[model samples]
Target: MEQSTTIEIKDNSFARQFETIIPEGLLTVEYSFQERKIFLTKINTPDEFQDEIFLDNLIRTILDNAIEQRLKVVPTYPRIVQFFKKNPQYKELLPPGIRI
Candidate 1:
């Protein structure tokens, strides 16, 4: 029998961050509101689960959450830019005017 993989994403209001939890571990993306800018800080994903497919899906999920909350995001992590650079198809998931 094949076991289903359950990935859960949550917004931690007190911490001002978004969290994605899976069997491997937790992934966190922090954000802050400054005037018209929404600063999306570090993205911490489990080292073991940093494969391309996983990273792509995870990033997409985070971006979707941000849109649902009507928040503009500025992804500060270099990896995010790298991911989009390598897979331009996913660039549509990003909001307008995001540097990366």
Candidate 2:
């Protein structure tokens, strides 16, 4: 799973997900917001969009989005939980008492 050269993500509130359209298809992070928190529940990425850098950047971008909305993140998805574990700096975006 190699990544594209660039990515552009957008919030599709109607679908309750964040998405980026690429040549292969759509890369999406499914989510639900509640009580000032955003629960990252799932991710959909075609094989062609799967690269470490791309995944890192996508997760990082979502964290940045959470920061802008002043929302804490609850990573219910295993992949996002793993991401949080690997990137400690983003842990601050997690709610208090939450751990990867």
Highest TM-score against the true fold, candidate: 2
Work out the TM-score per prediction.
0.64, 0.87
- Which pairs of residues clash in candidate 2, taking residues 3 or more apart in a chain or in different chains? none
> lDDT tens string, model 1, 23-42?
67887877787654456677
Model 1 residue runs over 4 Å out of place are 1-7, 86-100
lDDT per residue for candidate 2 within 1-100, as digits (tens), equals 4353445788999999999876778889999988999999999988876566777778888888789989999999999999899888898998989977
Residue 48, candidate 2: how far off, in angstroms?
4.1
Winning candidate number (lDDT): 2
Worst 10 residues of 1 by lDDT: 1-10
